[model samples]
Target chain A: MRLVISFIAGLVFSAGLVVSGMANPAKVVNFLDFSGSWDPSLAFVMIGAIAVASIGFRLVGENSKPFSAPRFDLPNRKDIDRPLISGAIFFGVGWGLSGYCPGPALVSLVLSSQAMLSLFPMMLLGMWIAKKTA
Target chain B: METLFTPWHSLFGGILIGSAAVLMLWGCGQILGVSGLLSRLLPPWSSSQDIKVRVAFVAGVIALPLLAMVSGQVSSIPPVNGNPLYLGLAGLVMGYGTVRGNGCTSGHGVCGISRLSQRSIVATLVFMATAAVTVYIARHLLGWI
Candidate 1:
């Protein structure tokens, strides 16, 4: 079923995050620190992920619909706008500050991490604010 | 402390993530984006179907990691900025920024670039640059996170 597949996908995705070292905030922050003792591990994560994903997109291009769904929900927006740039900058700053992006932060929840425990609620609040403003 | 660059694990992990994206696309006919999926769980969302996907996906995300930890496969304590206040600030900024930009690392950085979307490429560059600058300021200039 579709639900089973989603769960499996989630499991695989989380495993990747863990194995890639993206789940470690300290490691991520070190990767972001270009001027410092830079760890280029994170770059490989993107490189590896994109390389595989590109093939997936190619396969999808040949198909009209997904296997389990009626239609594919790929983003059609192409324009580079103000909000995009500004939002990205903010996101970047946040990423640099704590090295805890949403995905990894969520994974860290099982650890009962003090930082994520605080970050998660605030993140939801931020999302709520964004929704309200938009 | 000296930080080690782990190419093998990083690359392998990335491949797994990509595989998941591929499966999601092929099986679910949807982009496998963490923040995007998380956003759907919020208010004013579309329908129950959306809820099911998010719930099932997130449950798996959490469940596996939890199992992994029990097996001693996952354990990471943030070396810097363990302070809740600082993390909370970062979280708020990230949450808003990701929504405003319409994606994050998984959504735009990986999936978008994989599809070779111009918007995603630019957004990824901008975020990567800004993140580098932010780290420079916090670590080198300000001497703090």
Candidate 2:
């Protein structure tokens, strides 16, 4: 049941990504290009997502556990550390350079372009290295 | 302005994303954090149940667009014409950063802020500012992008 719900959620999320033009690298780049031809569409997407989720989080907070699971596995860490800042900086630079975050990058795997081919494998490698080092 | 501002589509899509996050939270008792899901695929980071859920989620993400294409809901996949080397490098760095930082835009920007998490708020700001600065340097100053 939990897996089914997760699958459905993932499907909906991916559809949203496509419909919102987030799967489009050009649109993402334009959104980040504040100095140049700026597109604020993605900002609305973020706002809309956050607003809706905020309500959901509040509602869910009332329950001791979710419908199908034993516990809620939300992040509890609050400290701001070097790893957090440096990691965010690295992630930001990467995002600005490619305009492909994890979700969109995975979604683009079906395209089988040279860029996706190279990017995906390297991304996996990077994750693997991080896992090993950490 | 006309070409860039897609208010309706973005808003609708965002609603869909939020609904998904809600479903994951309410039904599955999990935060809909894509990077965390992907990272769980690695050994030592996931249990059997975690792998199952992650796989299911990834399958859904991969299958939706393909289904849409078959149904003609989507005309075509977008072209990714960036320099392959740079893009690959960016992916590598992003992968590492996401693991180290413990979240991505979806995790920190969406779910984190919605929950009013202090760490997430700070992380989102740092990443957004970094992204803006990086874009300024790469696109405007260096003209590489």
Candidate 3:
């Protein structure tokens, strides 16, 4: 049942990505492109996502058990750590460069995007390195 | 690059994405962070892990788009900045950043901010500012794109 729910959620999430034009690299990069044809639609994506998720999250109690799972697995890190800042910097640079984040990058795979295909192996390597160093 | 300013469609899609996150949290008691999911799915598998759930979620993410494409709902796949070398570099940095940052656009930007997580909000701001600056450098200063 959990797996089924997860699968369905993934589908819904990807559906949103596709519908929002977020699955398009050009659209994403254009949003970042301030001096050259800037599109602020992605901002709406952020706002819309937050509004619904915030309301939904209100249902979960801080110490309450989940409906089907043992316990909530949310992050517990409280401080603004070094890794977070450095990582965001790197991720932002990458995002600005290619407009491919983890979610949309994976979604683009259904289309067999040549760019994503090429980047996949290297991305794995980077992740592996991060794990080792961490 | 062409700009797609479809606010309504973007909002609708975001709602769907948020609903998906809420579903995962409600059902599985997990934060739906795509990078975190991928990190677990890849190497050095842990003995006690919900590997199946991760696989199922990722499978669904891939499946819907494929189904849509097969059914002609999506007419075409837009080219994602055709330079493989550049994309490879960006992907490498992004992968590292996500794992290091402990979240991605979906995980940190959407779920974190909604939950009022300080780290997530700061991370989101940092990335947004950096991304905007990077774009400025690339499009305005460098004129690469």
Candidate 4:
């Protein structure tokens, strides 16, 4: 049942990416391209997501035991550690260069695009390195 | 299409994603963190772990879009013209960042930041900053579009 729900949800999420023009690397690249033919569509998506999530989150917090779990799995650590900073830098640099964030990249995988095939392996390698170093 | 984005459309889409995340959590006690789900692939995996939840979480991620398609929220897939090499490089960097940061954009940027998490704020900042720099270097320094 959970798997079924997740599968359906993934389809929705990926479809959203496609509809919102996020799945398109060109569109994403255009958004990143501030100087030339800049596209601000992604900003709208961000704004939209923030607005909805913000309100919904408040509602969810009102009740204790958000789930069967005893408590929320909130991050306990709160330090300006090296891994933290370095990770941010890496993420930003990568986003700027490719405009393909994790969400969109994963969704793009289903398409079997030549780019997705090549990019997927590199992403795996990066993850492997991060685990080792961090 | 109009040059500027429609505010309501953005709002609706955001609401959908955010609400979906909340619903999943409330209903199933799951956090929509992609990295968390992927981490399950690690060794010594225990069956005690909520395999159903993990599978559902991933399934939800993939299914949401197809639902949108059936409802006509999504029209069709668009064209991808970016260089494969650059995309691959970016993917590598992101995967590494996911581990180093301990979360992905959705996890840190959305869930963590929403809780007024200092780490998440820094993570989000780093995400934005690096992304900006990467674009600058790629477009200006490398001249590779």
- Candidate 4, residues A15-125, lDDT tens digits: the string is 456556666666666666666656777776666656666677677777686545545544578887888888878877776666666777666655434667777778767
Can you tell me the CAPRI class of model 4?
A: medium
Q: What is the descending TM-score order?
A: 1, 3, 2, 4
Among all windows of 10 consecutive residues in model 2 chain B, the one with the lowest summed lDDT is B74-83
> True-contact fraction for model 1?
0.79
TM-score of 2: 0.94
A86-130 per-residue lDDT for model 2 (tens digits): 888888988877778888887787643456888888887777777
Best by lDDT: 3
Assess candidate 4 and give its lDDT: 0.65
lDDT of 1 at B77: 61
For model 3 chain B, the run of ten residues with the poorest summed lDDT: B75-84
lDDT of candidate 3 over A77-127, digit per residue (tens): 899999999999988998888788888888888765677777777777777
Candidate 4 stretches greater than 4 Å from native:
A1-12, A67-71, B1-7, B42-49, B64-83
Over the stretch A17-115, how does candidate 1's per-residue lDDT look in tens digits? Answer: 988988887788889887788999999999999999999789877988888777887899999999899989988988889887778878888754676
Q: How accurate locally is residue A121 in candidate 2, as Cα lDDT from 0 to 100?
A: 82
lDDT of 1: 0.85
Task: Sort the predicted structures by lDDT, highest score first.
Answer: 3, 1, 2, 4
What CAPRI class is candidate 3? medium
Please, what are the lDDT tens digits per residue for candidate 3 over residues B1-145? 6775899999999999899999999988989899999898877888777999999999999999899988988855655457788878988998999899999999999999999999999999999899889888877798766
Better of 3 and 4 by lDDT: 3
